[model samples]
Target: MVGDAHRAPETAAGRLGRRLLTGWAVLGFVYLFIPIAVIVGYSFNDPAGKFNIIWRRFTFDNWAHAFERGPLTEAMVRSLQIAGIAAIAATVLGGLVALALARYRFRGGALIEILLVLPLTTPEIVLGASLLSLFIDLDQQRGFWTIVIAHVLFCTSFVALTIKARIRGFDWTLEDAAMDLGAPPWRTFSRVTLPLIMPGILAAALLSFALSIDDFIITFFNAGTTETFPLRIFGASRNEISPQINVLATVVLLASVALLLAGVAARARVEGRPVVVLTDTDG
Candidate 1:
C-alpha cells in the first residue's frame, strides 16, 4: 500500500512536469510567431491613419497596389540589385577559397582557416565601424558600391564556411578518374565536380544574398546617399508607417519561403532522394 501510494504520486508529478513543458513549448512558438502574424495580418489592413499598427479593416488594396509606394519600390529594387551583385561576388571568391581549403593541404592552411573564421566571430558593429574608417582613410565615398563591398566582406566568410562544410568529405578520386578518362580539367570540373557541389554553391549563394538584403548596420554605415528597402522602411517608420511596408515585407517573406521550397525540391530531384546526402553512402 505504501509502495503504491508512492508510485501514484511519482506518476502524477511526471505528468505535471510534461504538461508544464508542453505548455512552455506552445508559448515559445506563439511568442516567436506573434510578430510575424501581426506583420502578415496588417498587410491587408486599410488604415485611416498613416501608421498601420492598429487594425482598421481588411482589404486587398495593399496587395493589389504593392508598388504604389514609389520610393519604397525603388529602394526594394536597389536592394535586390545590390544583393544579387554582392552575393555573386562573394560566392565566386568564397567558393574558390572553400575548394582550396577542402581539396588542398599546404602551408598557412590553419592560419587561413583562422582568418576566415575571425570575420564571422567579430561583432557586426565593430566590423561596420572599421570598414567605415577604412573608406574614410582611402578617400572613398559611401554609396552603393561601398555597401556592396561591405556586404561582400562579411558575406564571403559565411559562404566559405558553409561551402567548406558541404564539400569537406568530397572524394577527389572522382576528379582524378575524370581526368584520367581524357577529360580536360575545365570539362571535368563542369561535368562532374561542379554538378556534385552545385547544391552547396547554391545554398551559399542564397545565404549570401539573404545576408546582403537583410544587412542593416554595415549598410547603414556605408550607405551615404543610397537607400535600401530596410533603410527606407526604417526611415519611414519614424515619420509615417504605411501598410505598404507590411505588404512588401510579407511579399519578401513569401518569396524567400518559395525559393527555399524550390531549392529543396530541386535538390531532391537532382539527388533522387527525399533528403540530401552529407556523405558518400546513405545509411
Candidate 2:
C-alpha cells in the first residue's frame, strides 16, 4: 500500500509534464501557422485590403492577374532557373568537398571546414556588399548568372553540412570491404558510399534549391536589371500592396510547404521506415 501510494505521485508528475509539453507544442505550432494562415487568407481577398483577412468578399482576380499580367510569373520562372542551376552547382561542389572531408584527415582540415561554413555565418548584407564590390572590380555583368553564383556560395555550405553529417554517421567498413574485394576507389564510392549517402545529397539539393529560390538580399545586389521573385515583390511593395502580391506570396508559401514535406519524406525513407504515402494508399 505504501509503495503504491509513493508511485502515484510520480505517475501524476509524469502526466503533468506530458500535458505541459503538449501544450507548449500546440502553442509553438499556432505561432508558426497563424502568419501562414493569414497570408493564404489574404491571397483570396476579393476587395483587397492592407490586412490579409477581409470581412467583405473573396475573388480570384488577384491570382489571375499575378499569373497573367503581373511580373510575378516572370520572376517565378527566373527564380526557378537560378535556383536549379545553383542547387546543381552547389550540390556537386559541396558533395565532393564533403566526401573529401569525410574520407581523409588532411592538414588544415578544420580551417577548410571553417571557411566552408563562414559564408553561412556571415551577415547576408555583408556578403552581398562584398560580392557586389568584387563583381564591380572584375567588371562582371550583374544579372541572372551573378545571382546564381552568389546563391551557390552560401548554398554550398548547407549542402556540405548536410552531406557531411550523413557521412559522419556512415559505416566506413562497407566501403573498405568493397575496396578490399578488388573494386576500384571510384567503383567502391559509386556502389557503396553513394548509395548510402544519396538521400542526404538529395535532401541537401532540395534545401539548397529552396534557399536559393527564396533568397532576397544577395540576389537583389547581384541582379541588376534582371528581377528575381523576391526582388519583384520588394519593388511592388514600394508602389502599393496589391492582391497579386498576396497570390505570389501564397505560391511561395505552398512551395515551401511542399519542399518541407518532401524533405521529411526523404528522411523517413533514408531511415528505412515505411513512407506515409504508401501506408495511406494501402489503407
RMSD, each candidate, Å?
5.4, 5.7
Q: Identify the leading candidate in terms of TM-score.
A: 1
- Give the Å error, residue 101, model 2: 0.5
Model 1: pairs clashing at backbone N, Cα or C within 3 Å: none
User: What lDDT tens digits, residue by residue, belong to model 1 across residues 1-283?
Assistant: 4667556455788989999999999999999999999999999999988989889899999999998859999999999999999999999999999999999988888998899999889988889999999999999999999999999988899999999999998988888887887879997777778878888999999999999999988888889878998898887888889888999999999999999899889877887853323223322
lDDT of 2 by residue, 1-283 (tens): 4668556456788989999999999999999899778777877777545534454677777776767755778888889999999999999999999988987879988998999989988999999999999999999999988998999999999999889987795667777777787779987766667767788898899889989999999888899899998898788776656666678788877878897888788777667854222112221
Model 1, poorest ten-residue lDDT window?
274-283
Clashing pairs in 2: none
Q: Report the C-alpha displacement of residue 275, candidate 2, in angstroms.
A: 16
> TM-score for every candidate vs. truth?
0.89, 0.83
Top-lDDT candidate index: 1
